[model samples]
Structures are given as C-alpha cells and as structure tokens.
Target: MTTATAFDPMSEDYQQNPFGYYRAMRHEAPAYFIESMGVWALFRYEDVVTTLRRPELYSSRDWINNALGEFDPVPQVPSIISSDPPDHARLRRLASKAFVPGLIKKMEPGIRGLISELLDEVQDRSEFDYVSDFAANVPVNVTAQILGADKTIARNEFKRWTADLIRSGARSVLPQEELDRIHRSVNELRGYFTELIAYRRIHPGDDLVSALVQAEEDQQVLSADEVLSLTFIIQFGGAETPSHLISSALWECFGDPALLDAVKTDPDVLPLVIDETFRHVSPVRFLGRTTTQDIELHGKVIPADSVLLSYIASACRDETVFAEPDTFDINRPGLSRHLALGMGPHYCIGAVLGKMMCGLALGMTLQRMPNLRPVADDVTWLPSPWVRGLASYLVAP
Candidate 1:
C-alpha cells in the first residue's frame, strides 16, 4: 500500500523521521490527497517547485494561517504573505527595502553581541536546554532590535507570542486551551504592533518599523493595518525559524565529530553547515497554497479553491536533485537551491537576517564552547506537522 493512504502529518512517527514517508510519497504517490488535512500534497521536487513558482495558477491568498485553521472565518489580512500579484508585489517592494542584505549586514555587530551575551548566561551551567536557553533567544532579540522594540520588554513578550503562534500553527487539531492561547497571542501581537507602528510614526528611527513607517513606493505606502500584518509575519518568521535552524544545525554537528571540527576550524564552513542542516531537517516543512483553477498533474485533477500543501522538506531531499540526498553533507553541490526558505515572489524576505543569525550563533558557540556535547539519547521533535524542530535539546559545555 502507498504511504499516502495512511499518512498523518501529526503522527509521532512522522514527527521523528518524516523523510522515509516523504520518500514513499515521492515514489509511490506524487500527488496525494490527504483527507484529514483536506489538501492535495505535492511530494516531488519538481512538482513542489512548479506549485511554488506558478503564483498565478496557485494563489497564496489562503496561506499558512488559513491552512492551520487560525481564523474560523479567516479575516482577510493585508499581509504580503497572503496576497497575490499587484498587492503582493507592492507589499514586498516596501518590505524589501528594510530587509536588504546590505542593511542586514549593518546589524551584525549588535546581533553578534547579543549572541555572545546569551551564551554567557549558560557558560557556568554544565548542562542546559539549548532550545530554551540559547537557541530561542537569538532571533527574538534580533527581531525586536530590527523593529526598534526595547529588548528588555520585547524579548519576553515576543518570545511568548512567537511560541504560541508557532505552536498553534504546527498542528491541525489542538486542545481548546491551546486554541484560546493561540488566539490570545494573535490579538496581543496585533495590539502590540499597532501601538509600535503608531509610536514609530511620530518618533521614527533607523529600524524596520520606522522604515516601513516612512517607506513610499510610487507615492503609495503601507497602511497602519498593512504594517501591522507585515510586522506580525516578520516577528514570527524571524523568531521561530532561526531558533530551529540554529539548534538543529548544532544537533547535527554534534553527532559528527569531523563535521564539527571542520566548522570549528573554518568560519566559512559554518554557513555551509547551516545550509545543509536546513536541507537535511527543514524547520518549516510545508507551505500552503490555493488552486486558482482546475489543473491536471500525474493524471489527477485538482479542483479550484482547494488547498495545496507543497512539501518543501520533501523537495529538499529529492534524490533527483541532490546526490545521496538522505545524507548530510555540507560540501554538497547546489546547496543554494534548497527551498527551506522558499522561492518565487514569496521567498523569505528575512532570509539574509535569518542566515546571519544562525551562522553567527553556530560560529560563536563553536568558538566559545568548542567542547559542547549533546546529552540526549534521542531527538524529541515538536508535535507540530507544519514545523520540524526539536522541542528541547540538552547539551553540555
């Protein structure tokens, strides 16, 4: 029987090692229908790429939040992530100015300093939860700094909000309490950003929020609501994705002595390691899209308005694309092509910042605590299908 028939994204087995199931799906049923989730899943590399690139045919109007069943009625938020064409393009253009690589590079010193301080907190401890103690802190602080939030306040509040949003999005079914927390966090996030945007309007600074506050394209600018939506995306994406990337990369490196040694010796190897880790264990597993029209693929027809879950994690491991795709190799060719950060018009705007934060986090950790070792016997992945990440990893210095 094809694995597709029994596939469950939220299963414990899938959470631990989804690659085997992904392999079966790619080989046995390229375009499989998942009933529980009510979406057509694309498993192969080329098919996922086609779905991602063809924005006109596959509308992103109903994106991640909608797929996770966030809003029962799903209010139409003016966010770039869920918009198509002219609207998406305009939002992207304004947001892009603040996310430019050159601008991101300027923030490196502050980011590096923050990473150093976080590591310092765990120096005396023999063992600690890397995810909670270190990995989780980097992105929140950086995101807060970028948006001009006071680090003291943003670190705690954004951490909770980001955690709730991520936890809420990971699973399709959740307890009522969890759902309530999720909605509460969403409201708190919007409320916080609304106040921040208004504050930035009058007292602008050299931060992303202020930049978005002032950014104008062709005499058109972002509305307060638009800015709020975009900020929500950036804060959540920036905080959650990189923490997993950093923790997962270290977990992988800790398993291989030679790879760990190679990264520790050469700073350049750290980025390569980060890329391979992303390919090997993608933090964000699948992205959602809605079909704009009926389309036939692999002799099956997908109806219009149906949600499509493109398995990006599966695409990253497609044997047709990478040699020994199952193996983790930093030297693997075409590492740049991995879709962990996504592709096309909706490619991650904070990619530059995300990579930098991860690389710096890994590099500095290796530099400061070269004797780091994993204390866990088996990796415990978070119980969320949308994101593949460690819930907690114990490590010793």
Candidate 2:
C-alpha cells in the first residue's frame, strides 16, 4: 500500500468531523502521502488555494473520468462533471449561459413561495424531521418550479435517491452489495428524466426543462444524454448538497441556544451567519483531482498524474488563515476565503443558486418555526467522503 492509503479518510473519527486529523496533517504531514489510497492530501489553506487556481496543471480530468466513466458504468443518465475539454468546455458554456445571474434571480419569488408551502406542513406540528419534512423538500421543489416540474412529484423519493448517489461515491471501493440498489435507481432516474425531456420537447414551457429542450430545437444544443445527465445534475446537484449544508448549519445554530437566539432576533445577520456556517461545515469535505504536471507545495513535490484531494474543511480552520479556528462563530471576519465552493473555472456552477436557496430555506424555517428542535437521536451523516452532510435530523419544538 502507498502512503496516502494508510489513513482511512472515511473512518468514524474523520467522518464524525475531520478537523482534528486534518489539523494534525497540516503540521506533521502537510503534504503527507496516503499509503492505502496512493494519493496526497494538501490540508493547509495555501496549498488548497494554489492547487485550485491552476486546473490546467492540477487537472480535474480524473473526477470527470471516474465519475461518468467508471464509477457506476450503467448507461442511463450521463453528466458533464466527468468529461474533459473540449466536451467539458462546450457543456460548461451552455450551462453558464443558462445559470446567468439575472436568470437565477428571477426564480427567487417562486422559491420563496415553495419554501413557505413546505414549512406550512410543519407549522401545526410540534416536532418534525428537519431533514425530510423541511430541508429535503425545499430545494427539489424550488428546482421543480424553476424547471416547470410538478412540485408534488419532485418530492417523491428525493431523500432516498440522493442518499444512494452520495453513498455510491463512498462504496466505490467497498462491498458491491452495499451500493447495488443505486444502479437500479440510476436507471429509473434516467428514464424518468428521459420522459420529462421528451415531454418538454413536444410541449415547451417557461421552466428550465423547456429551456434546454428549446436550446436543442433552436440550434445544435446539448445531446439528449447530456440533457438527461445535467437535468439529474441540476435536480440532485441543486437539491442534495445545499439541503444538508443548511441542516448542518442549523444543527450548529440550534444546537447552541445562544447562537440560535442571536440569528432569530437579528434578521439582517442571517446571511452572514449562513455564509460562515458553510465555511466551517462545508457540505463537501474533500474532492480529488489529478496533477497534470509536477508541482511543489510547502517544499514537497507532487509528481504529474498523481491524484490529490484538497481538504477544504481543513483549509477553513487553518490557524494562519483565521483567529480561533475551531470556534464556530457566524460573525467571524474573512470567512469568505474558505474554499467551500472551490476556486477557478471548475468551481461549483450552482454556488450562487445554492446559496440563495439554502439561505431562503433556513430563513423561512426560522421565521415560521422559531421553536423547531431536533429529537434525541444521533445525527447520521451521509456515507461519502465527497459530500459531508447528515442523512436525516429528527426534530421537535
């Protein structure tokens, strides 16, 4: 086994929250080799920022390659996340135009309405599973409205399917039976989207689905397969990641009565609080990329074609970057430097939308259900190194 693989990143210690091990890595092994996985992890802020900026040199090729190519290998829906340029460039251009700032802003009112209705169910109840009752539904519903899909159908099996996808990333190397169900889900999901795309083509509307379908009708648009993949990407991507981030952030806030009250009273302070929570408990703990060429960091060499995982969660807590790094203060200054959304061209495309949606979801819940509280159960985290979030949170007021 190589050095990187020696320390299992998915261990309960790391999975519970990896700040401790990552902190050790920053000092004792800033660019330490993992014997088991045969990769290097750069835990410090400087190395992460530098690595993210030069994607051409520190390539995203592997993530795209493994994700779409080898990860599942079942041919149902394919996404651009696993493709390389010029294909990557082509798909990204179309998507960037689709997600332009003005276009995203237009959905705010509709998103707010969707949030209001979802929380409406919990208004009369004393306790609720924050993950399912509230968090899981908001993003998918908001996305459905944007895509002109039925809000009713959008909520169906959202939690289970997305959970399986996250788990697929984890069991990529484990017992096959653990993730066998995901393959069937993927096929069903693809066919579900395939029908939706076809319907949108025949009868276009103002939703995103219609928009993409029109793109195909008007010109040489994205392939049918690309549409299916990006649609799933938009649905799951727009939904799962931020939904859990919102949950984790709330867990931190409500978990602390003092912090919870502060945000409740000061409405203006909520946005900053949300942003800071993301910096501290970023939804994605780590992501891997291959080195396109040899590079140097902290005086250590990273050879070409080598795989590197940047621990953004670790970078946010670097002592040199922020004061009292371990403390979770929503009001902390300069928390923006955290690489939660990553850096450079390949940075998360849905970041702005994700932020708006998450902020709206949390803001509405707090405003509507100020007394909401989680039940007495250990928060079960999603099983994946790629995404860090709870599987569910049972709560009561």
lDDT of 1 by residue, 317-343 (tens): 999999999899998899889999889
Question: Best by lDDT, which number?
Answer: 1
Worst 10 residues of 2 by lDDT: 69-78
Global fold similarity of model 2 (TM-score) = 0.87
254-344: candidate 2 lDDT, tens digit per residue:
7678888876777776777778877878887776778888887778898999989888888988999988988888767787777888876
Assess the local accuracy of residue 175 in candidate 2 as a C-alpha lDDT between 0 and 100: 74
Off by over 4 Å in 1: 68-76, 170-172
TM-score of each: 0.95, 0.87
The positional error of residue 351 in candidate 2, measured at the CA in angstroms, is 1.5
Looking at model 1, report the run of 10 residues with the lowest lDDT sum.
Answer: 67-76
- Please give the CA lDDT of all the candidate structures: 0.86, 0.74
